[model samples]
Target chain A: MIEVINLRKSFNGQEILHGVNLKVNDGQSLALIGGSGRGKSVLLKHIIGLLKPDSGKILIDNEDISKLRGRKLKRLKERFGMVFQGGALFDSLTVFENIAFPLREKTRMRASQIRKTVSEELAEVGLSGAENKYPAEISGGMKKRVALARCLVMSPEIILFDEPTTGLDPLIGKAIHTMIRSCQKSYKFTSIMVTHEIPDIFSMVDRVAMLYNGVIHAEGTPEEIQTSKDPVIHQFIHGELEGPISIN
Target chain B: MIQILTLLRIIGAFVIFVIRETGRMGIFLAEAIFWIPFPPYLFGRVVRQINFIGVKTTLVILLTGTFTGMVLALQIYFTLSKFGAESRLGPIVALSLIKELGPVICALMVTGRAGSALAAEIGIMRITEQIDALDTMALNPYKYLIIPNLIAGVISLPLLNFIFVFVGVWGGYSVGVGIMGLSSGTYFGNIRDFVTGADILEGLYKSLSFGMLITWISCYKGYFTGYGAEGVSKSTTQAVVLSSVTILIWNYFLTSILVA
Candidate 1:
């Protein structure tokens, strides 16, 4: 379980997050939907302890991750997995090496064992054969899958996805959605995914949270958000210009 | 006056931040170095970095070091000969090359070749959130990225300086003997006479110190990059400028304190 309470963050004096509050139960997927520059990424960073909150606590598994530091902080950080939006694979390492990275760095597993584990994870992602190739040689969707494999290598309890399907075509997007659903079903890990695509929310998500006006404007089941009578949620879900929210 | 004081304070803050961060890096480096004696080591990455950083720059360091050594020897020889103290040229050439010129030149060459590129690459990784991704996955980026880079730099710079001094003094001896018609034996004997245990240690010290400074500055810039591409360019530029300036400053200080 993870809880965010009155989280506020600012960059260069311009307040980005204004007292946001959220929570995710165990083995659940909560997609935070908002427009670009809506502090979705900021909130995600704070939860991962990437961006420090100005005030408030981000509690992961009953521990306040915000106050942790050094090796202790790093240990807490190890419990979470983050897939950067652009499929941030290390270009220098091959796909096999990339997925094997966390296991080698963090655990005491032998080389042969590591090799077996990496192959298994790659197969799980449906990317078994491309292990020898560099990130640049692969497709964008494949890179995301590799990132996903790397994320799972550590067996994290809570996974954070930052715009996973942003650049891929719709066909690949559904495939990615399926992959997400399948992984969640198997692992039963809590997940917080930041995304803009409505279809993704409709097809796969169990619950949705709408972030607007620097706070969670609405939160309910996917069905509830889609059928929301509130002007802000309705306007946002329909991608309309004129509503209770301004263009800015 | 108030504005100046505020400006000075900002600069002081930045310096303090650099000092603290570098100290943290040094502590991490010490722990990692301690692990070097343990078994199951991988020298593949280290060897690759050495080849890329040291072996690749062999010709450039040689050319620059040779010219510098030759010029220093000739100028000192001419001036000392006019004073009927020509034999002092041997010690002067050896002292200057070992204590000052070799390390400075080698560091500058690397700052130009590898340091700038390192900063840029790191900056890109930081901005693109790759490093952060690594961190979230329970990986010690210090182990994977910092240790290899720091070790490669520290080992390579001194070896590079050794090459520089050898090539440089040889160039000087050849110029004094072949081109300027001085006796070859006399030129060789002078460098040999002047090179002491202290001089060799001083050069090695300078080489290692400058290597640490150059690599750390570049790494730090890249590690904390902001503002995307523009930020990356800024960090690379800052890494080169600061490392180059610090090298010259440290060379002067080390020479004054150690050699004097």
Candidate 2:
């Protein structure tokens, strides 16, 4: 289980997160939806220890993450994986090398075993013969899949996706969503995805949380959030511009 | 009075910023040094960086060293001949190349070639979140990224400086003996007599320090880069400029102390 209590973050004297609270039980998939620049990525960064919160307690499996430092923090972080918006694939590495990076760096696996594991991961992501290709040589969607394979190769207990499907086409984005749903079922990792896919994301995630004005405006099952009557939630979900949520 | 106060305030702010940044850079250097002795030594990466920062830089160093020596011999030959002291040309050229010009020029060239690229590459990684990705993977960016460059810089600069000085001496010999009609024996003999162990060691020390300064400033700039393409470009420019200026300024102090 992961719990965030009164998380707050500020940058350049402007508060982006204001004592926000959230939680995700073990083995559950939560989709964090919010307007652009609403600190969705910031919140994800805090959970992964990328950005330290100004004030709050982020407890991962009941261990306070903010308090952990050095080797302890690194040990805790080993249990987590993050898929960045741009895939964050190492540009210098080939697709196979990218997926095999964590294993090579962190594990004592033999070359044959590492190759076997990477091949299985590539196959899982449906990029079976594309191992030798570099990130620049592949399409954006393919890069995301490679990123996912790399993340999953570690079999992390928690996976964080930061706007994973932001720039892909609708078909590709849906394919990615389906891949995530299938992977979640297979890996059973606790998942939190920051996305703007709206209705498409509803079916993939078990729970949905809407962040507005630096706080989680509403949290519930996908169905409840879909049918929510709150003006902010309705305006955001339906993509309506004029509502309690300011466009700015 | 108000104008003077405003100027003082501006100077105060600049000083504070410099002090803060220096402190931060010192801490960064400390952290990079701390990770040097840990496991997963990354020897391959260090070699690759040495190739990039050292081997690839050899051609430019040779060209510059040769021309610099040639020019020094020609100019010094003319000046020394006027005073009936042309016999001192070899020693002057040898001493200048070994003690001062070799390390300083070689470092400046490296700053332009490798230091700028290091800053830009790491800055792009920063803006693209690759650094964050490394952290999330339980990999220390300092280990995988900064330390190899640090090691490579320390290893590469002195070797390049040696190459520069060797090539420069021959360059000077070609001009002093081959063109100036001086005895090759006199030129060689003067150089052997005048240049000492301390002079070569002084050059080695300067090169090593230059290496550390170039990589340290470049890596620090890139690691703390701001957002986007503009940020990367700015860091690259700053890395080159700062590394070059720092090398020159640092060479002065090292030379003063070594000479003393």
Candidate 3:
């Protein structure tokens, strides 16, 4: 479970998020659909404790994580697996070490155990034989899967995917969506995915929140999001330029 | 009063930044040092850096060492010759090569080669988001990136200093005795008389501190580098500049403190 209250953020004097509040119950899948530079990634980073909001409280499992610092913050961070916008795999490390990273860091599992767990997770992601390859050696879709495998390796209770399908082809993106739905069901994880792929996310999400003008203008189920009377949300969902959203 | 307050505030912020960054580096250093206590050592990465990042730059070190020794010999000879003690060239060159020239030259050379490369590599890693990946897995990027380089730089500089002194003294010897037709007896005797245990200790001490300085600055700049590709290149250049300046500045102060 994750909860954020009145989250306000600014970068260098420009406000990005203005009093945004949201929450997800245990075992819920929520999708945040927004245009670029709309604070989705920033908000996700705050939840991950990678960045702190100017004012707001982010609670994970009822613990305040927004202001956590030092080693304490790092330990809190290890609890959740995150698939970044890019795969973000270490260039120098093999896929085995990449996925095994969390297990090795957070647990006393030996190398043999780590190898076994990493392979299992890789297999779960359909990347079993690709373990020895580096990120550069893999396809974009495979890299994302490796990232997801790493995220799920700790058996983390929650997973955050930032634009999981941003750079993938349409077919690959659909495969990723299948993986998301199936994995979330199998793992029973509380998932918050920040994405711009409205249709793919709408098809997979239980609920949706549309961020606009530094606030969540609408929150609803998939049908409510598509048919809502809210100009910003409707225009974004419909990909229409005739509404309040500027063409630029 | 406002000027003084502003100055104090700037200093406060700088101090805080250093403290915060230092703490980041320290936590990482602790984790890295802890892993050293266990089996399946990750020194493979460290050894790669030492071999590629440190050893591959030997030619540059040799070039800088030889020229530096030659310059020191010329300067000391000119200054001491005026006092009709031109024979002091051997002693002056020996002392300079052993104490100051050796470590400082080696540090600068390594900074140009290893320090810049280390900074750029980490800076690229930072810009490319690879380090952020480590964070997601609960693996500390600072530990994985900074500590190994810090230890490598710390451990490598002294070894490099030893090489620099040996080659630099040989270069100085070549110029003073071989090229200048000075007798080997006078040169070797002067060196034997002039070099002391304290002097050698002083140079090693300066080298250790210089190692720490170059490694810290380069690693910090690279670790926190903000921009993208442009930022990586900028940090690389900045690392060299900062490391070199820090070395020169610290060399003087450290020599004065530890040597005098």
Chain A: TM-score in each model = 0.97, 0.99, 0.95
Poorest 10 consecutive residues by lDDT, candidate 3 chain A: A66-75
lDDT of candidate 1 at residue A196, scale 0 to 100? 86
Number of clashes recorded per candidate: 0, 0, 0
CA deviation > 4 Å runs, candidate 1: B1-48, B84-86
Model 3, A84-120: lDDT tens digits are: 8888887888999888877766789999988888889
For model 1, the chain A TM-score is 0.97
Off by over 4 Å in 2: none
DockQ comparisons of all candidates to the true complex: 0.67, 0.91, 0.56
Q: Is candidate 1 or candidate 2 better by DockQ?
A: 2
Docking class for model 1 is medium
Query: Across residues B1-260, which tens digit of lDDT does each residue of candidate 2 receive?
Result: 99999999999999999899999999999999998998779999999999999999999999999999999999999999999998888899989998899999999999999999999999999998899999999999999999999999999999999999888988988998999999988898998999999889998999999999999999999999977999999999999998998898888888888878
Pairs of residues at least 3 apart in sequence or in different chains that clash in candidate 3: none
Better of 2 and 3 by DockQ: 2
**Candidates' TM-scores?**
0.90, 0.99, 0.88
Better of 2 and 3 by TM-score: 2
Give a tens-digit lDDT track for model 2, residues A63-94.
Answer: 98989988899899999999999999999999
State how far residue A211 of model 1 sits from its true place (Å): 1.2
Cα error, candidate 3, residue B152 (Å): 2.0
